[model samples]
Target chain A: MEEVHGRHSSGWFDVCQHRRMSNTRSLPLLAPESDAAAGPCCPPLTERPFTAEEAETAARMFKALGDPVRLRLFSAVASHEGGEACVCDISDVGVSQPTVSHHLKKLKEAGLLTSERRGTWVYYRVEPSVLSAMGKLLTVAPAVL
Target chain B: MEEVHGRHSSGWFDVCQHRRMSNTRSLPLLAPESDAAAGPCCPPLTERPFTAEEAETAARMFKALGDPVRLRLFSAVASHEGGEACVCDISDVGVSQPTVSHHLKKLKEAGLLTSERRGTWVYYRVEPSVLSAMGKLLTVAPAVL
Candidate 1:
């Protein structure tokens, strides 16, 4: 997945490499690198109950996505071509530009997105693993499980 | 899926059949029966930007799950054996029974769980389609898409 973003030169990987140090706010909510490497952050909801700590972490991410405007903004960035979007390109969500920036910051703080400053514009990208991690969190295990 | 619940006899399907009329609160948030039949409620977030309406519906569901206590309770019932759990079996989440009941009601209102009263106890079941619908909402489109 890192190699797939080669077109961005070192910019994308630089963000990924520095994400942990700079984005400490995302540490509690984001799936750890180990979990991303292994699989979803935890087993499906149907497989077992979530511990209090697990519930807290997952709840933070869900809470960030619980707003309609934020959700729309997130979907816009997620669905944008090349799996990234410029704030200028995707900020038309019926709200003021500052509000959109606020929402994007919330999404980034929640670990659902990663952003970078490119020239004069800030570009947002959904971490490739986040969507699947969230999806898997709510997944119902197969009957055999 | 309907037939798979033969053990519950008519009780389960009775809830499903009457769900629309009785649980009108859930209607706005839940994916319609047609969406369930066809596939996920909408294209994955990465596949397309969500309409305001879509964002509203999805946000409602996510908001209901944004609380740690509610999420833990939901997980308890979801992970219970036989895909269902009696109220008495899952009310030990460090909260009062009434509080637990309140959380369960919110979950039901959000269309995450379905409840049926039998004798003195009410049983809750996670509608099989719901987990997958939610999972699909956050799924990333394959690179080919």
Candidate 2:
């Protein structure tokens, strides 16, 4: 396991170097512009009762973070340096690599994460706005002005 | 269904009046002081990776809000006119009364809410600090000062 982790870690560094040399533009799996255009998906729960559709959308995101392993993997990525992480760096959450990959896929599907495959490994990032959006969803509106 | 909702709504009003007249102190199921004493349970995920214990605790709260019905019910209580809501006022989320109670119980168990019994109704409050704590948990630290 250590050997595999080392190899992947080195592979990631190589990809970074390659990208710098070639000046290849990073292609995000989900367009950040689209997420911004979508706007805050729901008002703060303290602002008003969620519409059924809004509740469903918000619930999906929370559900994705409901498991300990998934939440750990997500935290590992979110807290990693540069607001992103290589799968190689974050697959150490006491789970098998396959399980780690599975959780990453679930997070991606739930729109909580965006990923790109640079070389042999995948890089994951929490969109800058996603966490703030979630915080806003649960925020207690400030005394209604 | 409408009739039942009306009855409950009136019951809540009655309870409110009784509390006002009798000068009864609200008895919160969980003391707000204890939550404050515990401090923020975990640093923002963006601040650092969570320990297994921290992730476990946080995941339980997220899991409790993971379901659509529970999320809706929580929103109902959270977004009600005041910081707190009577169960009677927020039980119209297209589920049976028992199911609504079940979801509310789950939320309380997760430490997301506190409740008090008054007359015929149970009043639920979002515990001002809990929402802020959750918001803080997801907040991206402000560019590390």
B-chain TM-score for every candidate: 0.71, 0.74
Tens-place lDDT digits, model 2, residues B53-116:
8889888888988998888888887776555677767777788999999999988888788887
In angstroms, how far off is A27's CA in candidate 2?
13
Clash number for each model: 0, 0
Model 1 lDDT per residue over A48-101, tens place: 888987788888888988999999888987886556777766776788889999
Q: Report the number of the highest-lDDT candidate.
A: 2
Q: What is the DockQ of candidate 1?
A: 0.41
Q: Give residue B134's lDDT in candidate 2 (0 to 100).
A: 79
The lDDT per prediction is 0.71, 0.73
- Residue pairs with colliding backbones in model 1 are none
iRMSD, per candidate, in listed order: 3.4, 2.5
lDDT of 1 by residue, B109-132 (tens): 887788988665587877667677
Q: Fnat per model, in the order given?
A: 0.79, 0.73
